[model samples]
Target: MTPASTDAKAIWRAFERTARADPGATALSTPGASVTREELATLASKIASAMRGAGVREHSVVTLMLPNSVEFVAAFLAVTQLPALAALVSTRYKASELRSIWAGIRPDAILVPPQHAAGVARLLDIERQHDMVVPGTDQVLRLLCVRSSGPASVLDVRERFGLRDPGSFPALFKFSSGATGTPKAVLWTAANVGAAAANVVETMGLDASDVVLAPVPLSHSYGFDLGILPLVFAGASLVIRDGFRPKTILTDLVDERISVFLGVPVMYRVLNRTRLDQVPDLSSVRYHVCSTAPLSVAQIEAFRRRFNAPIFQHYGSSETGGICLHVPSEIALRPGSVGRAMKNVGVSVVGTNGGALPAGCRGEVVISGEATAAGYVQGETVHDRNGFQDGFQDGCYRTGDVGFLDADGFLYLDGSRAGVVNVGGWKVSLAEVARVLESHPCVVESAVTAQTNPRRKQRVIAAVTLHDPAEEAELIAFCQARLADYKVPRRVHVLEQLPRAASGRVVLSADDLPS
Candidate 1:
């Protein structure tokens, strides 16, 4: 499809077209419930009607915090069908973390599980609330509308947040895992969302016959862009699992005849270690796509030996939907590379001068394509270095990833420009972890770094000089309270003094840190 064709397709409308074509086909399934294309569409329509009655309109922002269930899917579709932006928040986030993110997006409404309604109401100063039963499940969702001083208007919200007016209102809103201090809120226009889904369909060869099993959270960009979007654009079947259980996932792989599996490196690592009664034939599986973190050659080999399916590593960001994916046919030739750019996407390595570097020279990875987001939103300014150079339609995103393109155009990542460590699939900022540790009264200063373990991939390690005596577990527990579990250091070392250079900057390395 050309840019013009994709530009005309809205994400929700694309799903509607697919649903109309195959109304009886299974659109989504969970262990407890299932929904056909027609049923899911009708559910979304009903929810949209209810939202409209509650004063939701075009340009309104609705935050969704739910687990990976059919209700989450319907809520997302319902919001976008109204042409309102849907902001996805992880269900695992604590109230403190939620407040930090809400300060930027300032959602007009929030949809959460009934158990979380009281917490959300307290945070948003909700003026009205209602209990709504999810169509196909026993679950109940609490829809709360924030208190308003005057008439409901998107203009007031936009001005308050300092968001620019794109030609079209954005269809999706997401927050990055904080490259530095605070998480950055990003907005993607409907065209951008559609283009991303189209690119995945074209590149991954997805269709109505394929059944995908997604254990990852659909709220994440990895799952939303690849899992949900593909189901809508290609009319494929989706099997959702709330959490990962190796034995249960193994059984579902064969029971469901899943054709595609969306996962991360940590999942593959666990699966490799899981003992199966008997290895079942998984020939029905066409693609086992891994993203959110890098995969080691050993892990890839182990998976291929066990399942006879090669693991394809996908590389992208929340800002850019799907950049590079290791295609099945090219897996052997480009073993370590994240493969070439996805269809309709461009990837280049450029030096500081902004000129394209030679194939063998390492430089900043730049992306320009239909899948790139318009720009950062909420409190982030588009003029920053991370923002698009021109605009989403004709501009490029300077990805902070440091890598070089091979002579054959394959991309290999060396590292990121920022101080980030990948814990499982979640990106944890080293500076942020250090700050959390320093906040503890027992610590005078702290340094955090990433250490690679053969069994666990990458884990966060911290060293601290303490004014008061404290055990490593105590420090870790403190971090667990203040930060996300992934950001919490796996191990904490009590140090008398950290190695410093003449400039007084802590010079700490994983190798030099005490075990």
Candidate 2:
């Protein structure tokens, strides 16, 4: 295998070569069926050939909106083979959100599933209503529709739109919810992605013998990095599931003899809630990785006890790739820690003055590494001289998380520096409160913030969406029991749905809740 630094395009070429070397080996598996390496490569080749015939060239931006399936993998690799930029858009995004994203970066072409054509057409209509000019059609172009088991339609949409390759384009554009209250797209190059993928494979000690079961959506960072990229790089078989269901997941794990399981804390919590006897014996699995959100000490320990496998809690953001992870050896010793920095990544806790702090002191966690991204699409560059070091000094990417490293090199997260709430001099982490509220039985989702109180200065308020409205008080009582007196929410507001951005992060506004 070639080193990750060889070139971003080299990784795809290597995978294509590997597929040819072991044509009959299984590459991807889902509940519906499985695809051999030969089949996977042939499908990708067909798609790439079709794209070339349709006038796609190097550096063209192709927006992909599809569900998690074999088609997604084929489309992603097919575009990358031409070294074209691939933008993976969430299927859940609304028309308004789509307009905002498309307006900023006009993609040369778009690939949507047949099922999403109507919703996409609706979005184009909404765009026209606002006098916004979409890229392809007078309305949105229903250009490419993926067939179940046949050839892909290559319409003259590319010629119709008069699109052409501009030049060298970013490898991927992932939209993230910005702190300034808007959606910001993060641009990453093929080189950056290849480095990040290599870092993950090395850090996790993955091998071709490993079988990874992924239940998270590939559009998100966690799924894309840990779930998809590592498997592709290591030539490991991927067991792709559309979504997470504890019972079904457990059954698949045992049946597939899965070696690696990656998911979020919420998924593990759901699995832990299932009856122990009903849970399959996952003795074959060696690692269970969790990220996207924090995993409580209780949840971590519970998962370990039930599964008899080490549960690694990792911490990272979409801006920078995998930052920190708790090692399997330290699982028992440092239950809450996210682990030491991975190879080629620098981790630091800086004080308010931007100076590096001593061990055991809480400060903002900053990271720099090979996996760090170039920058956001239209947002400010986060790299700084004192902190970021021009992207070379130790290659450390400054992570915005607030955490501290113990004397033994274990990283303990305190909270996020951006989302802290000052309640009359008492600092509270909104993430901490949100975690407690989300643990409630009736609460499906929750967002916590500091609401102004004329007399008390500020009070903790929680806006929540519940499965049952009548259980609001009961849920509040549940949170009151688990959280500290100061951390407990003083007021709980029930809503049919919580506001969220296209990236799936909760959106809170001053006028949305009580002040």
Model 1 clash pairs are none
* Residue-wise C-alpha lDDT for candidate 1, range 1-515, written one tens digit per residue: 22233222266787888899989999999987779999999999888888888776666778998889899998998887776778888776667667877776777789999888887777777889877777656778888988754224445444544446534435677666633324556777676787888788898888999899999888888888888988888888999998789889888888998888988765776677666778766556788888875666666777888877898899977788889888677787677778889999999999988899999998889998867776765543333224444223345788778889999889988656677767889988776787667667566567788898879699899898876799999999999999988888888999877654211235467886866
* Candidate achieving the largest lDDT: 1
RMSD of 2: 7.3
Report the lDDT of model 1 for residue 51: 86
Q: How well is each residue in 357-399 modelled by candidate 2, as lDDT tens digits? A: 9999998888776566655443223222224332222345555
Cα RMSD for candidates in order: 10.0, 7.3
What TM-score should be assigned to candidate 2? Answer: 0.82
Candidate 2: where is the Cα deviation over 4 Å? 1-8, 121-169, 178-181, 379-396, 438-446, 452-457, 463-486, 493-515
Which 10 consecutive residues of model 1 have the lowest summed lDDT?
A: 1-10
TM-score, each model?
A: 0.79, 0.82
